[model samples]
Target: MGVHTLAELTTFQVGGPIAALYEPQTHDHLVETLRELWSEGEEPLIIGGGSNLVAGDEGYDGPVVRIAHPGLEVVPAEPGRIVLRVSAGVVWDDLVAHTVSSGWSGLEALSGIPGSVGAAPIQNIGAYGQEVSAVLSAVELLDRYGEDPVWVSADELELGYRTSVLKRHRGEPAERDAVVLTVEFVLTDAAGLSAPIAYGQLAGALGVELGTQLPVADVRASVLALRASKGMVRDLSDRDTFSAGSFFTNPIVPLAAARSLPEDAPRWPVTPVAVEPTVIPLDHYTGELPGYAPTAAPELVKLSAAWLIEHAGISKGFRLPGSRAAISSKHTLALTNTGGATGDEVAALARFVQARVSAEFGVQLVPEPVLVGVEI
Candidate 1:
């Protein structure tokens, strides 16, 4: 009931104050509250776990909304499948842990990532070869401009590499005008066996070959250990975890640009998997099968942003003179608040890193967080 600041709402822990805070405890209440606000010509700043946000020191001048409706229900699932419907406000990691403990075959590889269920699809959050899109089936959302609440297929969101239609980036309007209310996932019930491993690092940690399937619980344990070692998993006792994990996303550039960087810079070709040609029965065969030449996609490379930052004269744990914000000592991709750091200081550090990286390799790093009232 008293004053609450964005610092308290976000992991970054450095914003001024909110004009008003709304925490709806029920799904119906959430919709009702937002509609009422919209009717009154007020659009609140909506937040969930606040893991991927960087607010300004001056803070948001408008009202803020935090979805607090708790839901994690196992609904009707077809044979060999598990259907779990999660409310927008449910803690994402809690869902993962629950699934793993219940012998669910999916969501194990995504352990330790922060934020709420509603946020997962917004960023298409992926880690250790498993993406939320792989299991997500549909979502229910409300259109801010009075579009009726409806269920939309996951494909409608246009999920891609760390971006989705719902995500507002660089202060631009979102492609879609809707707020997610809930999400539905179709998980597997493969006798507790996980999906095939696709990440080399995770495989190495699990002491298995790539594409090996292990117990869901084991995979979850390994993922949690790996994340904790890198100071990525949030822990109250660790100052290194006081951050919005991974301040910048890995940069994707043309192969030529990638090759121009130091040979040691880690890079992987961005290639899509080939789709098998469709087969038709002899009696039902169609003529020619429609000969069409697909346009060739130019070769692009995904570069290691951490490697670039370290090589561009920015070391892990580097901090500006007299600033409390410092790059995390354990992870180069993260910018952490040592203690009492301001949002402006964080932005300054981010801009400095951007300038140095661009000057060194001509690669512009894109920030991963949602910025409010701050320019970087």
Candidate 2:
């Protein structure tokens, strides 16, 4: 079979061709194709909706497995709690719509995210204060090093802010050689009520205070509207939404480092819990009970990426000389393809932005998308 170009498969629309692109329509076919590739000494690149990926101009020469199997089943669980076993290929927004329409609440905040269910847990995808980890039950995974698929609990994924065990960090291979076959989410019925609005912007839009619960449908609508305003919702006619959303993630810095920045910089504290005193064994005790010294928990602060970019002198719609790539006019965080931008152009722009931010604020911005054969 002729392969699809990464340009043809990715949201960035700037990659070169691949040796093969397999879109398996069934779970069995997906597994069999992966196994065949592995047996042939090929480690296939798995792609979902291609929303959170960036590929290079040189292109990939190996098999590219695109998970397209679609299924969503409601598993019976305890009352007021619903469990959904969703296939990997299920469009993420479609799942959100289904849950909201069914009077579910947990996924409403992540309404306009463009990706597949399979990709969500890989990054512990979150928005508007609601993360996938809040409701994830388990992931059905096909371990590349094991025989059959197994169900790994959510806690095992070690989901953190926009990261997980399945995610590959910069300059590192994927931590886990497993493919997500399905994801199970345990959501609340909520009796048509949405989860508490934790983000101030979202809360204001809903005309409620933080921790207030509105209608699930209303919450979805407000979130979609907010995302559209920021050019996050995908639209074929809108060039501002052409790029992968949020090129750089909000950087998490320690409290001391965060304080070094200007006071106006947007910052949010990630509070740490109090640590309990360690118990000493009688045989290992060296002296009297340890002095009642209280240790202050380390404080983590999330600095806004968009703020850093703007402060670094890269304004919205900023572009290099004669470069086809530019920052999105609607959002500073998005590095857009103005028109006919190559992967190299996009990567160069990303590196420029990173250099500017790092030089100005001493904060190195990291690319949020999974780059294939490309470095920024």
Candidate 3:
């Protein structure tokens, strides 16, 4: 029962000491730990890199299970389809770099986001106009209520924009509990060409048509470079990188409201059912637009939370008087611990930004990271 502080495990460099932490190196050991804990009436919280989590300063009182399982196998199930079975505990960007280096195309656009591969499909991670859901075929999970692992097709997970059934709760009419052990992605033999470059910047960088394909390695390089500029890529020495990636899911608003905003309100067609709103309104004379925009419609519009934060007068490194927690100096969306901060201080900073954004824009900024022992 080794113990460590959340500060030691998470990117945020905050949080108190956990009661007990267990790292299972193999699947059998992981299952055994779970079974033994269950027999003792303990339900441990599963953790990976702790990138997308905000542990309370008080820390978790229960057992913490860290999945250390590792393996990546490329199995050819058919002539053109290759199922890449990746352990859930694998660091995500490392896997992306690996796949691209091997001439694989599907995972390129998701290049630089932090956290483990196992946590990717939980929210169907997306960036630069590409999402993991498009390539995910199935997931192998250890049912919290059952014994053996079962394979659930992508459809069963009900993946959505930044959401999935695993994230949604079950039982309590909204409670859902299932631990993902491994994930399989179905990749195509594209002969070094990347997936159709749906994102505009990416397409521009590759100097190809929107639906055209470029070399997979080129696409990966471009995506990584772009992410690094925004502080989205994790850098241990850069305090700005001490975050859970984006702090908020881009808000998807109704098309009518989007259209009513201004002729230049940034918008893009999302699904056939919805529109995505970009934070930089086309008519936004404020000159405060962020780099990305949404391109969906009818179902919802994507709006940048970072844009809203700045628009609400919260600038980079904004902090309450005498508070150690502050907004990232390099990125407006991330709330960082400059030094000597606590969970409560971080939560306070998040609340201040949330309230300011909501009051100014009439749209609430929902947090992107999962909160443990604290409410945002």
Give the better candidate number (1 or 3) by TM-score. Answer: 1
lDDT tens readout by residue for model 1, 1-376: 5678899999889788989999999899999989988989996888999999898899888889998699988898688899988999999999999999888877999999989999999988988889999998999999888646899999999998889999989656679978889999999988989999999999999999999999999999999999998898999989889899999999989887987998889998888445565676889876656564454555889999999999998887899999999999998999999999999999999999999999999999999998888888
In model 2, what are the clashing residue pairs, if there are any? none
TM-score for all models, in order of appearance: 0.93, 0.94, 0.88
Which stretches in model 3 have alpha-carbon errors above 4 Å? Answer: 168-175, 260-263, 272-299
Between candidates 1 and 2, which one is better according to TM-score?
2
Given candidate 1, what's the lDDT at residue 109? 90
Give the Cα-based TM-score of candidate 2 against the true structure: 0.94
The runs of at least 3 residues in candidate 1 whose Cα sits more than 4 Å from the true structure, single-residue gaps closed, are: 272-295
lDDT of 2 at 339: 82
Q: What's the ranking of the predictions by TM-score, best on top?
A: 2, 1, 3
Location of the lowest summed lDDT over 10 successive residues in candidate 1: 289-298
Candidate 2 Cα errors over 4 Å, as ranges: 273-297
Report lDDT per candidate: 0.90, 0.91, 0.81
lDDT of 2 by residue, 156-245 (tens): 998988999999886367788799999999999989999999999999988999999999999999999999998999999999888899
